[model samples]
Target: MPTPSTPLGEFDLIGKYFTRPVQRVALGVGDDCALLQPAPGMQLAVSSDMLVEGRHFLSTVAPERLGHKALAVNLSDLAACGARPLAFTLALSMPRVDERFLEGFSRGLFALAEAHGCELAGGDTTQGPLNICITVFGEVPPGQALLRSGARAGDDVYVSGTVGDARLALEAFRGTVALAGDHFEQARVAMEQPQPRVALGLALRGIASSAIDVSDGLLGDLRHILQRSNVGATLEVDRLPRTAVLAAQPLALQRECTLAGGDDYELVFTAAPAQAEAVQAAARQAATPVTRIGRIEAGSVLVLVDAQGQTVADHFGSFDHFKS
Candidate 1:
């Protein structure tokens, strides 16, 4: 537990670990709050997400990684909308705060914030069941934020990065697998550390007709864009990038994990068929692979079809927001 005079005093806590990096800014960390100066005509985008132990992550997971992922996932939302991360406010509530935990948490958080170009603004701190909520601010050109409703019939669907590693990692982390081996390492890292597709998301702004981050199952999350865009999708099973670690598993398990498992912060987007080359080039530049996973159709259902066009059942069904 932390006290006023504890080594983890909020002042030192903020200064030693949460320092903001230099970037395109109206202000840096330290003040009533961090201020921002958006370039002329750019609009502001704000988003937030909370991570709770034993819910969003395991209670035994390291605090530093939890801090990083909580922030990174929220930033992923901003990136999905083609926004440049500007600043963030963190709200931390823990049952009992330890100095080591605080220090490690802040260090992990700042490292990602620095890479993502977001400032650590002001927010409240308190005692609770260890929930980390991060609200991030971003900037995008006026009237140009990517919306989920922009997908059109005939647009090619795409996704950045592989799927399922995070979910596999979570299961392994919870001791579900004793034989996971190096596969466990891959999945654990994917789960504990999420790389928000900031650059790809930004580049896709004007190009992708619609986009979303796959925090939920890929099919479930893609349905959001398709539903909003008033179209259907035919997901191609062959194109999903399954890591070697993930592929070594049984086929059914692999498909189930990739389609329904959450926490892989990859971009699922739709673009004109003419833009496929550009999308491929941009992804190449970022050194991130983009796979052409499907095509938008005129119907309203998001369906999966094999190369032979046979329909597959919902692998794990849509991830439920609530259940007993």
Candidate 2:
């Protein structure tokens, strides 16, 4: 709960900053529990994501962007499951009640929520280390949700949007890589704000056999699908779609970021070869670009090859909370 020093108490803080009336749910905030009524023939899909001050983001990030990202990451999980956003709950903790910060955070948070028709059903606030956790609820038709275990041999692998931009921005912030002003800003936007592919995921429900969001890295997230489906993949290094900023970097850096960079938030999915046309149509319907980067194969190993079919021999690992 927020301290008493500020005019806003815990209940007042929640009412002022987090409460919102919801139509989809029978009961919303100010109640003991939220009552969500899933649409007929639809199953409730829920996902939660946590963002700490230093571990998930730099403290220098804008409060608005942080609010957007805190919820966006959870929404990305809903997207991976081919679900439609319905409502959400936010659990927020901070050292003190900063009215300015809360104003900006709520603005960004509600803006995205409104854009996706996700209502704020309930949440909690407290005085502690800065942490934002959001649990989003969505809906999907029965047995229609995309899973990581459906990929099969001979399926075409695809990824939505360009990759590696977020990593480039992070490297620049760390002073590990230098970038031009325009390039850094462009990459920084990718890092600070990522669009969840909700429409793309919904569109790919029947077309894509398996799908996962590129939160930890392209290869790492893809490996989950591969492992679950008992399949392997052959990636065409040159086929990866990268931003102009990332493309201008050295081959090693480009590969490193594109393969192992976390926080991209793009969708990596697989569909049967016969569904290629349908996949393109789904992309068009969503108005999101999709690229075919590789093909799934028999076995459980992922092979990265250049245009010449030569294996790339560099080790790249994704971001793990415990081991990066």
Candidate 3:
């Protein structure tokens, strides 16, 4: 393998690291445009995400992990809609064509793609600041795809897996918090290599009334559902699930992280009160744990409450591209 200083041409770079035989797409790399064929009775779900250096990830992250995350974040979008993976196109910009970095990045990206049975289609590469943009394609049956606007007044709000760990990791990286070595590693993994709950999303089809992936934060992402569904919610702050590490933090910190910590790729969804049993069944079938956190209400404001049913003040703000 050549070093970072090696003069690798554009076509050579794509051919050597990004090219792969197509399995799901009608056409793949080496073409002007990739062709896709969605299955009958299904609607195509498309989403794209961009990650910039020093903004989306730290400068010290391993290339392989960065690669995995670049795709994982986009797949999280598809999971929110209960769509099955199909294919993706990668558009990358880098300061230079470093063979070592390309090797590790492609390895991480393709590994996750193969696990989801998603193939690489066609895309472009250019010389610039390090940036990764991926456009993913998925399919879901008509009328079965989950949306943010489906929650009702009586729907139960649930979140799959845990939240706040990624924010904790980010705090550690930023020197705002201190953590033991192993604890930092665990949280760091949660931040860098989030597992998209595709299986859980698939199982929740026809079960979840509304759905959104926890990319920005639980409270922030949940607001999208509330606004779109025209409903309010009373979240039991103490009931928000967390790992033991995060649980050991201060009460205020724990609430802030769980409520407003972004980068946790878990799913936050709503379902009917009558479908509680069905929701549990779906979780069991998907091998993911889900916890009921709150209930949707008639108003248009989100209220936070303690375990004792006291209304708590809302103060934390989630990640905003411009504000943060």
Reference-based TM-score of each model: 0.92, 0.97, 0.98
Alpha carbon lDDT of residue 235, candidate 2?
Answer: 93
In lDDT terms, which candidate is top?
3
What lDDT is reached at residue 110 by model 2? 88
The TM-score of predicted model 3 comes to 0.98
Worst 10 residues of 2 by lDDT: 1-10
Task: Note the residue pairs that clash in candidate 2.
Answer: none
Deviation of model 2 at 170, angstroms: 0.6
Writing each residue's lDDT as its tens digit, candidate 1 over 89-150 gives: 88888776577788778878888988886877667677778888899999998878989999
lDDT of 3 by residue, 1-324 (tens): 555567788998999999998887898899789999889878999999999988899988899999999999999999999999999999999998788899999999999999999899999999999999999999999999999999999899999999999999999988988999999999999998999999999999999999999988999999999999999998999999999989988988899999999899999999999999999999999899999999999999999999999999999787898998
- What's the C-alpha lDDT at position 247 in model 1? 85
- The residue-by-residue lDDT of candidate 2 on 87-162, one tens digit each, is 9988899898888899889988888888899999988889999999899999999999999999999999999999
Ten-residue stretch with the least lDDT total in model 3: 1-10
What lDDT score is found at residue 8 in candidate 3?
A: 85
